[model samples]
Target: MDDSKEAESQLNEKLYETRMKFANLWESCNPVRFKQKYGESLKITRDRCIEIYEEEKQMCDKVEITKKNIAEQNALIKKMQEDLQIANQKFESNNKQKQEMLKKIKQLKEELAKKQELISTQKQENKAKLKELNTSAEMFKKRMGLEIRRVHGEQLQFIFKCINSKNPEQLFTFLLRFNEEGNYEVMSCDPPLECMPLLQEKLKETNNLSAFLANVRKAFAALV
Candidate 1:
């Protein structure tokens, strides 16, 4: 391709040189004066005139051909330049669009990262709250059990005091009523106790409340 361009340049230079030579030949020729001086020798002058005319005509034809070629080449060069300019503009536009897309993608990734961090933080907070609630519930259960045991101890002391008192039968009757109140009904203790069973037999046989009370106290001691 470089060789072809070099050849074309050399051809253009030669054509220009030839055209300039023809122009100089026309400028130096004094046609009217030559005719006036050579009219007496008309035959010689007429032949010379015809030869010069043919030369001028051939030069003009060559110049016209060169001009036509130059015009066509100029038109082609203008079109090529325009095409190159359009291509460059398109390339710049595509590059600008690519840069914008990259920026948007980077922004989206940053937002996603922030959202993921927030979700992880929320999960950790929820776990901590659940642990705290479980700890509080355990403490409440222990406190409730302790309170029930303490109240049961007080009731047991009172029953022990009335175990062999005067009018023991009347005391037993009162104790039976007290047991029915359900205050000492501790289902979660190490061992369970019920006062109603102890008095049931005695009350049926001889209405002997003292014996029932004594028997219940003994059973109570063994259970504890």
Candidate 2:
């Protein structure tokens, strides 16, 4: 009966030791104690995640601004192209107007030259006509002078013949000529007669050939 009590006591001591070990493991693995030990590391990780999110948002904003700038530049380029086209059209129109004005000026200059040439031609024609009229007048004056001299010569010859017929016994002959002054002059008489000297003097004073001939014929008839 004593041996049986010693074995039972030993078994109870072992069971107590096992229960104590389980209790120590449970205390070491508690959820609240683990959180307390690692809380600083978890907070550092969360802050790093917030920094990356902010960087990504800033990059997105910069990309949006760049897109807006590109769109504005394109609009400005289109407006400049339209303005250049308008300026080119204006230049072409101005050039065309200038050419038309130059053409008109050339035509006007040609017309003026033609008018000047026509006036010059008319002046030459008028000068020729005036010269022709002056020549004709000179010719008419010379012809009329010759005719008057011829008529006076014939009248003198007839008068001398009549006077010779009247004076049969005393035949009279005279010399007649034109002097330097284009007048008739009695040079001399063949026989000296009383009327011859007086006839020459009267002819010098009066310059009338017909009257002198008539007076000389009357004086010769009276002497006969």
Candidate 3:
């Protein structure tokens, strides 16, 4: 606007100068004075026009440079905006992933707790079943009536070393039945009976007579 105003003012000034020269020429019939005065006026107006032209040219150059700078800045701003949008999208995606992972962790924790509860319930059920199994085993053994017999006298004087077995269900049913018939001494292997439970537990670890008898002997030695 300023450049346009300046150009307009220069053009108006030129038009005014031309009108004044024509008026002066019309008033003065003397061509000599007209030439001299008009020549100076023309020089001054030409110099003014040249000055205005230079100013206008400089302003045009400034406007072009400013336009170019504004264009570059706008392009840079657009690129920055695009980058920011992309970054925001990435951040949102990552945040969503983190939330999903947390949800998964929560689900896993709940499942683990449920599994632990199930295991505890199963253990309780197993205990009850084991108790029933033991009771049934005792009843079965009584019905079967398997008893140890015939194999010991002066020919095999044995010193029985065994756990201070109290569970009638757990006791060697064969030995008990024969003890009644044979009248064998049934003493606890231990002197204080402190290690008898451990002895029984050890014996229960195995199935064979060799291992069972070996643990009994170890209990006897421990008592001594």
Pick the TM-score winner. Answer: 3
1 or 3, which is superior by lDDT? Answer: 3
Clash number by candidate, in order = 0, 0, 0
For each candidate, the alpha-carbon lDDT, in order, equals 0.54, 0.60, 0.57
Query: What residue runs in model 3 are displaced by over 4 Å at the alpha carbon?
Result: 1-27, 125-224
Better of 1 and 2 by lDDT: 2
TM-score of each: 0.37, 0.39, 0.44
lDDT for 123 (candidate 1) = 56
**Model 1 TM-score, all chains together:** 0.37
RMSD versus native structure for model 2:
24.2
Off by over 4 Å in 2: 1-46, 129-224
lDDT of 3 by residue, 1-224 (tens): 99999999999999999999998778686788778889999999999999999999999999999999999999999999999999999999999999999999999999999988877776665555345434544443354322222244311112332233442232332221112222222333323345545544553444233444444445444443
lDDT of 1 by residue, 101-172 (tens): 999999999999987887667556544533433453344334321111123432322223223444333222
Better of 1 and 2 by TM-score: 2
100-213 in candidate 2: lDDT tens per residue? 999999999999998778766755654453343345334433532111122343222221333345443444445565454434556655454676777877877885554665
* By TM-score: ranked, best first: 3, 2, 1
Alpha carbon RMSD to native, model 1: 27.5
Residue range with the least summed lDDT across 10 consecutive positions in model 1: 144-153
